[model samples]
Target: MTEAAQKQQSEESEKRERSPGGKFMLVLLTGFLLAIPLFASWLLIYDRQSQSEQAEQSIVTGWGGQQVFSGPKIVLPYKAKVQGSVEQDGKTVTRTEIVMQNLYLSPEAMTFDSDIKTEVKSRSIYEVVIYNSNVTGLATFKLPDDFARSGIDPATIDFARAEIRFGLSDARGLAANNMLSVDGQPLVLQPGRGLGETGNRGFFAWLDATDLADGTITVKYDVKFRGTESLTMVPSAGQTNWSVTSQWPHPSFTGGFLPKNEVTEAGFTAKYAITNLALGSALTSTQASQQVYPQSNNRPYTSFDSSGEPSSVTINLIQPVDLYDQVSRATKYGFLFIGFTFVAFLLFDLIGGVRISSVQYILVGVALILFFVLLLAFAEIIGFALAYITASLATIGLITAYAASVLSTWRRASMIGGLLASLYAVIYILLSLEAYSLLIGSLLIFAALAGVMFVTRRLDWTRTLQKRPSS
Candidate 1:
């Protein structure tokens, strides 16, 4: 072949590789490959979240887990006779047998006042919120005047076997010097709750109902306990009032009822009032209490199984912001960051007559993905905001320096650096406005598309590809 013909053929081959269609297809393939790292980053986020949860659990277990308090109640045992028929000597014989059963009673009126102080316990990069609480309460109990009208003889009641029970979800959380009194007399508290199925894990004190000739009693108690995250109470009384104050600022008031009075910030004070009508007549009868109390067991009272409406106010000691959660949310936008950056590089290559190879595109994407890894690592040591600033500055600086060599001009590289900085800023905004992230992201993508279309409007793809190489 002639020398001129050989040169022309080589030029044609180079134009084919750099054609708009070929470049577009290569960009798509690169995007597909970028998914691998994106998925890997998500897996890392999931692992980190799991580790954080495990750390929280370990801390809580050591500090007597989340607590739920129920009842400063009275339980009375009684003997009853039931007539039944049984086969005897091949014939049915009728006999009366005595059975022992306990009657559960809630206070006619009850009040609880709690003062809680919170602290942070940390292991490695994880921190858990735990608390110490001093609780004081008073409860009044009275037998209904017509108690004998409930088809039971008052004479058969075992007033001597009466007991006062208090339910604590985790008995391990009870402080050593707990004080409980009835009628100004200090009572010896025992381990078992003694309220039969009406109580969970807790301590009970023996009481002599016979001493109260008027069939009325008043009791008071002081409790010091330690727990993690939250404390819950059951309003199993005719009228229940709870006043809870805590040094923890973020309190999640959850349950069947919300606090009527609440002041939140730096610390919180929440008061709840529950009427007996709202609690139903469950506390009046053992059979009813069994059904009513356990029904609330599935509600978000604590980690333990007990029954009531979300009737308790829970003051949760929560972090003002979750750095791990923020990092995870930012990582979800990894693909958009990689895609927009590559598109910008491609635009510079096509419109500015610069050359950026597929290998260079891959390298740039790898660097973008590395930003998240750096963020995760640094966030564990420091926090999200500082880690984000550090990782972004490092990645942008690295990529800008690399681009200067690839594009052969500081001006062009500086533009890329500015673009990257703008992108990082947009991501931070999206992270901050979680509620509006989708709207902002959609607008950004639309604006980016409009800019790309406007810049390429006058260019002829075929002619650009066939143009002589620029020196």
Candidate 2:
């Protein structure tokens, strides 16, 4: 061969011999195809999660949404006069306008003792948390002494139009067997939000002439109600005491006050004692003025913000672990599994003298992504842990068997299998220990990178390429 042609041929041969970085770039290019399937799997997980949430909301709608109570306040309806301009005989004149208003008096004391029974109701593959609470209440309401002297006429205060207002977030949750009594007389509730302004989300009952004896009213009620997820109480009284007992193991207590609580595998019991002193003066909004209900029943009794409503104490019935969340989290780690497994295969192909085609890389990628699909499907049926073990064993076995066929030895394949097993174990641990997952994952990436760099530190590129023997 001529000297120029021989030099050109040698350079061409060197170009075909890929460095370790160059080989990884090839692997990455091929791995890019995996994104299509990876994204598809992610979307599938999202769709399933959306379906599960929809099912829970469906169940809750048929039952009842979360329940909140703020009630047993005395609502004294009264008439107030306002001056307004009127046109009479084509001339403007001032006239006295008679408007209806109310005086809301907070209860001196309120107590709620509740026993909640929770159960898991399932719709297809979804489970929803629901509860039936048997709540008994005792409250006392006495008119504020200065109501008549709050710049309003005592004669205009219609004591006969007095109502006992009891607030509820969802009135439909009230069971048919509920009972309420004021001053030894049974009260028939009317469908209306008893409290004025933004805190008006409950039912009310009118009081008879003798019900408010000596300007004081006593209320007793036994309510058996069904609700989904959570229950809350508003302490709209001078002193509030609430006790809740539930047959569910997981109870998430939240809101303005933390209850003294005891929890066990069987159930939980929580108690809260809150005084108006802690509630502050906002709870007694418009207490200085007798007019509280509405300008003409078309507007709120007064301007209200969140402070207009009494701060609530809430308890949420939650599952210890949700399978959908576990699966979604696993799906997020999909690329890690793909990248690590590809690196193992790349190591064998480049240094161990194995020939792994892009088509084969694609097949292996398909198998890895299928693991997530299998996990989600079985998780719904058998829960997350067992399903994870099942999916991992199946995926690891499939890849290990294929590794033996491609790498041409049982020993090399065993190494691949061990790597797969370790990855799966690490992922499972990461999922279980969520608070420390980021720390663990960051450490894992650092270790993997260091190992890869160390392994390639002295690797030669000459052996990775097989040029035709010189003739």
Q: What is the TM-score of each candidate against the true structure?
A: 0.85, 0.86
| Models, CA RMSD each | 4.8, 4.7
lDDT of 2 by residue, 247-324 (tens): 899999988789999999999999999887776632223332334334334222322226664467889999888887
Poorly placed runs, candidate 2 (over 4 Å) = 1-19, 83-96, 145-150, 194-201, 209-214, 282-310, 460-464, 467-471
What C-alpha lDDT do the candidate models reach, one value each? 0.79, 0.79
Per-residue CA lDDT of candidate 1, range 103-208, in tens? 7778889998999999999988899888899999999888766676677666777888787887777777778898999889899989955333223577888888
The residue ranges of model 1 lying beyond 4 angstroms of the native Cα positions read: 1-18, 80-97, 144-153, 194-199, 211-214, 260-266, 287-310, 458-471
List the lowest-lDDT window of 10 residues for candidate 2: 296-305
Cα miss at 450, model 1 (Å)?
Answer: 2.0
What lDDT would candidate 2 get against the real structure? Answer: 0.79
Best by TM-score: 2
